[model samples]
Every structure is written in structure tokens, then in C-alpha cells.
Target: MNSEQRMKSEVEIWKRKMMKKSGMMNRITKKAQDKINGLIPEKAHKVITESIKKMVQATLFGSEYLTKPKETYNLSLEEKEALIKDSLNKFRKTAVVEGAGTGAGGLLLGLADFPLLLSIKMKFLFEVASIHGYDVKAYEERLFILYVFQLAFSSEEHKKNVLETISHWDEVKGELVDVDWQVLQQEYRDYIDFVKMLQLVPGIGAIVGAYANYNLLDQLGETAINAYRIRAFNRNEITEEIPLDSDK
Candidate 1:
């Protein structure tokens, strides 16, 4: 296959992976995650929720500290991906350092990691959007970032719903109401609780924090790449023959 065809094939593979049905293990895990969430103190949950809400809002509304959107109209898919990979590497290192520092600092710094890592994640998302040729200054583009965030960190059931929404975003974006931040925050918290809770432990928090943050950024990077690829494919910007199985 030629370069464009190869790119299209890669995107199709990603689409199939994204659409794959959740298995029994996924259901059981969600249940277990929910149970763990229940065991957390109510005050702790409230604190996390409020912190996430504020961080997300600030990022969405154009925090000056975040990366400005780059002009990407002339860049090819390969070029954009190269730039995105570079950004991902930089952010991954930053996360690892932040995690390690906080992890070693005990409970207070562990608590502080929540908002700090969140800011890093959000900043990376905005950069990814710009690299993919989307203007983050637009309100719709910001909402698209939130959808991508949800896709990365939500439960299987919610993932399915978000995938559907993103798949038809061009049609529904205009009619959509504001996102329910409460639900979004809860889903994100539950998804990450197990890994993040481990980051709060005294002895292993540093290792756990670094490892978890690195992997979390990696996961988010993959999700952001594929999400933009889906949009490009749907818009015929990257033309390739659809696989026979795509209609199934």
C-alpha cells in the first residue's frame, strides 16, 4: 500500500479496536472499581471531584500557561504524528518527574499530585488537538477534547456511549447540551482510583506514581491520536478503501 493507504489501514485498525465489545472481565472490573470507590471516604471523594472540576474548567477556558495551538494546515498525517509523538514523550517525562516527587513527599504531596497531573494531562490534550490541525480556541473543539478525555478514562459502558457520540460529532455537536461535569468527574475518578490509590502509599508511592503517570499519559496519547484519525477518515481527508468488515 502507498503512504495514504497505509495511514488509512492503521486508522481502520484503531477504529476496530475502539469499537470492540466489552468482555465479561470488563464488567467484573467495573464492579470491583465501583466497590473500591465506595470504600473511599465521602470527603475525599468530594475534594477530588472539586479539584478535577476546577482544573478542567480552567484548561477548557484557555489557561495562559497551557501550550498555544500551532498552525498545522500544511502538515501531513505523518508530520503531525511525529510532532505529537514528541509532545507525548516530553509530557511523559514531566509526569514521571512529577509523580516521583509527589510520591516521595508523602500524603500531602500525593494529594497535590491530583491537580498537578491533571493540569499536565489537559495541557497535553490541547497540544495534541493543535497538532492534529484542530483549533482549540473554538468551543466545539474544547468539547471534543473532553470527549477524548472521557474515551480514555471512562468505564466500558460509558466508553461505548462516548465512542458513538464522537463518531457522529459533526451531526450532534450543535444540538448537544453542556457536559454533566459531575458524571464525567465521577467516571474518571472511579477509572483511575485503584492505580492512583496505590500512589498514595508510603513506601511504594514514588515508584507507583511514576509508573502510573507514565502509562496514563501513554494511554491518553493513543486515544487522542485515534480520535483525530477517526475524524479525518470520516471527512475523507485520508482516503482509503473501507474494509469489508467495516460494514458489519
Candidate 2:
């Protein structure tokens, strides 16, 4: 079989191996704990806090792109279909407005993050780029929205333009409140990385993430698979390593 098929088959195998439910939950819980701890420092607070905030912003944008409007709200079949069609259109529009090609600038920093990316520590850059599932030019526009949410812009025009673009994205983004995020704390890190992996495998979709996650859980004993997956993605440490915020 070809490399892609081989890898896909291997993933399928891994899923089958990790099929136990309780074992998977334990692994997920452990992974969540580790991620939360990794998000903060054992003793220091300030630097890790800032870093956590930054990662949260990235993760938020990463996950927000996946959620949909509540279906519990009453709607006629016509309304539901309209909503589905509209959501599809919005994504297409997003693909266009944000740019589907490497150049569309979709919703990303347009051309700005490129230089900014160069200026920052390379490892963080890779991590951030991995937030796009290791696809930079392809997802530049979408990544731009995450940057807008987390960083300071040089000009008001840039900020306003980004805000407008975000405003125009009619599909549901994320939960309305912080508490909503708390509801899924156990899957937080996994979910964040799951979104990135979903971007990597476009056809997999959110349902696939769950399937993959649960499948992996059964196979890999419930721990988060991000570290392993990142390795699989071949994300490398920068040659001239940045001191990872010097707080870890």
C-alpha cells in the first residue's frame, strides 16, 4: 500500500487496539491533568499565566471553528435546512473571505503573521503553526483570527478589519461564556489538539475526532495522544531553540 494508505491503516489499527471505554476515560483524564499542569507552572505564576492565556486564545480559535448553533432551539424543517445550507455557505464564504488558497489570507493576519512569525522564537512559531495542523500558507487566514484574538496589532485599521471579519463569520464559534468551557475541562487539551488534527485530515470532521479519540483511548489507554501525534506530524524543535518562555 502507499504511504497515506499505510498510515491510515495504522491509525485504524491503533483505534482498534485502544477500544476500552473506562481505560480511555482514565487516559483522557490523565492527559487533561497533564495539559493543565503544563499550561501552568508548579511555582511561578506570571509567565506561565501569560503563556496559558496565549495558548487558550489559540485553542479557543482552534475549537471554535468546530462548534455549531444549538439544534435544541425550535425550528421548522425548512429553517433547519436553511441553517445547514447557510452554515455551509458561511464556511465556503469563510474559505473564500479568508482565502482557500495559500494566499486567500482567509482570516489570518493576511501577510503580517509571516514576519511576526519570523521574529518570535521558532519553537513557538512551530507550535502556533501546528495550531494550523502544520499547514501555514494553507490556513494562514484562519490562523489570523486566532492571532487577532490574542495579540496586539500595530494599527487600529488591522484590528478593526479583523474584528469585522470575525463578526461576519455567521456560524457559531464557541460557547457564550467561560463556564461553558469549564464543562469540557477533562477533554480540553485533547480537544484542542483534536481540532488541529481535524484540520490536518479535513475529511475526518469533528465526528472523526471523537471517533479517533475514543478509538485511540481504547487502544492507547485513555491518555492524550497529542505528543505522539505531534511527533507523527514531524513537528520539530527549532535548531536554535527558544527558551520556551523560560518558565517551564
Candidate 3:
């Protein structure tokens, strides 16, 4: 086909992927909602929204899927691996120099907000996979974690400030410097648990950040934590909100 035909064909394919008319898309949306409900925190609603926007923006600009989603070429396993590795390394280079910034142009996985510093980095990952793509989840998770850490790790320029900030939680009263290593590690462990949960669903690893977008910031913000804890504590008052169509 000509360039025009190819471009049109790619757009058609993207429309199919973005369209939610089919029940196929409904399942994805439901999963997204469930993830949101499971994760939404009262405090950091803005964080989640920004994160999703970053994810979508980053995917659109940084990923070939948005520009040439339909383009395909035969590559050996090694070649594909090399491509992913290269993309990941480039992203890491920035972190090794500067620290967490907003994602999308600012894209790299925003780490400026979380006082506890919950971050993940999936560098050079391919676009969304399908039911068959679930087998490689661990690599994706590792990539995500490394991508975020690289921000903290490689930030040579802001090394002093980033380190100082990470060492203590800046509070309204004063800087809580000299952070407890144990607590920071615990924070990582907590976020890792959520990452593990994403692996159970096929094609979700790519969109794991997206799925977490609705819940992670809120949970970290402790906005819903209190309410949820209250509901847990007062079982008698719990209404058990359930979606009517969920059963169907």
C-alpha cells in the first residue's frame, strides 16, 4: 500500500483498540474500574489522574505504537531484547543524572510527590500484550522498578538534594531528615505487593501503571485509608457497596 494507505490502516487499527463498543473493551473497562475502586485513596486523586495522563502521553510519544501501531517486522528474540534494553538504558541515563520529574516530556514516572517514594519503571516495554503475553510479567515488573530507581540512583546533578529529600519526609512542621531505612524499604515492599497483583492479569503488566493510576496515589495519601479502616473497624455500619451489573 502507499504511505497514505498505510497511515489510514494504522489509524483504523488504533480506533479498534481505543473503541469500547465491543464487550471485549467492556471487560477492560471493568477491570480498570475494579482496580480504581480497589486503589482509590481520598487524598491523592490528582496524583492518579496525572499519572494516567503521563502514562497515556508517554505511550503515545515514546512508544512506536501510537505512530505506527500496525508496523511489524521479523526480529529474532535477541534483537527484540536489545531494543527493549536500549530503551530502558536511555531512560535510566536521565535518572542517573537528574532525579524524579513528571512523566511525558516530563515523562519518566513522576516520583516527586510520594513522600514514601513509591515508584516503578518499565523501560522499553512493548505495547499491550494479550492473553498469551502473561508469561513474561516478572521482567516487566523489574523494568518498572529499575526505571524509577534509576531516577533516584543516577541523579548526579541533583544528587545532594534528592538524597536529602529521600532521607527525610518534608512535613508541614519541618524536614524529617535522616529517614529510617527500614521504613523506606517497607514502602518498596508494599508497592511491590501491588505490582505482583498486576501480573495475574494478562496484558496488564504493560498497563500496570495505568491500572494503579486510580488507586496508588490515594492509598499512599492516606485519604481513604482512614475511611476504609473505619469501615473495617465498624463492620456493623459497612454498606458493602457492590456494582449491580458486576454479577452479570
Candidate 4:
């Protein structure tokens, strides 16, 4: 197989793994998280959910004003991915520094890290979407970014569902009327609660925060790449191997 074919094969394998049934450990964790979520007051859940919803919406709507102009040059998949890797590294360092700084500040700054980190993640997604040749200025492209974010931090069951939608994004994206804010916020919160809770603790918060943020960025980067790969192939943008010299 040629390079594009090989990459397509890898993406298919990743999708299969992503869609697989949750293992015992995952089930156990989900059960525990569910119980914890159950104990929280409904009002509290609503407040948190709405907060995240608005935060994300604000970021999405305002990002166009802040982002660099969309890249217009046609690039082969491999060339596009090289640019993505460099962008990921830059964003990862920003996340790590932000995590460590806030974590070292104890309760107040640690609590502040939520919205801050959320912004960083969203910004990175916007950049990734741009690199993948999607215009985030378009509403549908913005929705795709949200799906990628959800896929990165959601439960296994949710991941499977999101993967299906992403796999058929061309058909599905047009039909997507709105996001389910409750599921988006709850799944994201539950996925990070355990580790992030530790980051709120005073003594080791810095170390925990830095480590958590680094890994989180790494996960986001991988998810964004594969998510775009699914779209790229679907659009026939990467149907054949193209030499690097032809990228210009």
C-alpha cells in the first residue's frame, strides 16, 4: 500500500478500537463517576453545565476575531500533519505552563484553571481545524470542533457515538441542529474530575496540574488528528499519496 493507504488503514484501526465496548475497568470507573454525579444536587449540576455551555459558546463565537487567517494553500496530508504536530507542541507547552502556574497557587488559582484550561483546549481545536483546511468561521466547522472535544474527554459509550457521527460527518453535520449541552458538560466534567480534583489540593497541586494538562493536550492532539483524518479521507482530500514537493 502507498502512504495515504497506510494512513487510512491506521485511522480505520483507531476507529475500531475507539468503538469497542468498554472493558471492566472502564465500566467500573464509569459506575463510580455516575454515583458521584448522582450525589450532586440537580441545581448545582445545572449551574455547572450552563457555565460550561456559555464558556464554550463564547469561545466559539469569539474565536474568529482572534484566530489567524485561514490557510488557503493546498497541502498533502503528510505536510498538513507536520504543521499540526508543530502546533500541538506549542499548545502543549502553553497548557503545561498554565497548569503548573495555576496549580502552584492553591485554591483560588486552581479553581480558576477550569475556564482557563477550557479556553486553551478550544483554541487548540480551532487551530487544528484550520490546519485540516476546515474554516472554523463556519458554524458547521465549529460544531465539528465541539465533537472532537467531546470525543477526547467523554466516556467510552459517548466516544463510540461521537465516532460514528464523525465518521459520517458530511452527512451528519448538516443534520446536526444543536449540541446537547448537558451531555457535553457532564461527560467532560466526569472524565477529568478525579485528576482535576487532585489538582485543587494545596501541596502537590502544581505537579499534578502540570502532569494532567500535558497528558490532556496529548490526548486532544491525537483525537483532533484522527478526527480530521476521518474528514480528510471522506472529502477525498487524501485519497492518494502525494510527494512533499507537490505540497506547494
Best by TM-score: 1
Q: Write the per-residue lDDT of candidate 3 for residues 1-248, one digit (tens) a residue.
A: 96434433443343233222337654565466557546634434445445434443443334322222213245432343344445444534433222222222121233332321222232222321111121223333222222223222221232233322322212211433222333333333333334433423344432443334334332222211121122222333424332112122
lDDT, candidate 1, 1-248, per-residue tens: 88767776776776566656668977786677677777766766777888889866875675543455678878887789899999999999999999999988887788788888888888888899888777777878888888999999887668878877787788789987567788889889877888787777799999999999999999899988877877777776444444424335
Assess every candidate by TM-score.
0.87, 0.24, 0.24, 0.85
Candidate 2: TM-score?
0.24
Best by lDDT: 1
* Candidate 4 runs further than 4 Å off: 27-51, 64-69, 237-248
Residue 207 lDDT (model 1): 97
Residue 146's C-alpha lDDT in candidate 3?
25
Model 4: lDDT to the true structure: 0.78
Better of 1 and 4 by lDDT: 1
**Candidate 3, position 167, lDDT:** 23
| Deviation from native of the Cα of residue 72 in model 3, angstroms | 6.1
For candidate 2, give the lDDT of residue 44. 27
Ranking by lDDT: 1, 4, 2, 3
Comparing 3 with 4 on TM-score, the higher-scoring candidate is 4
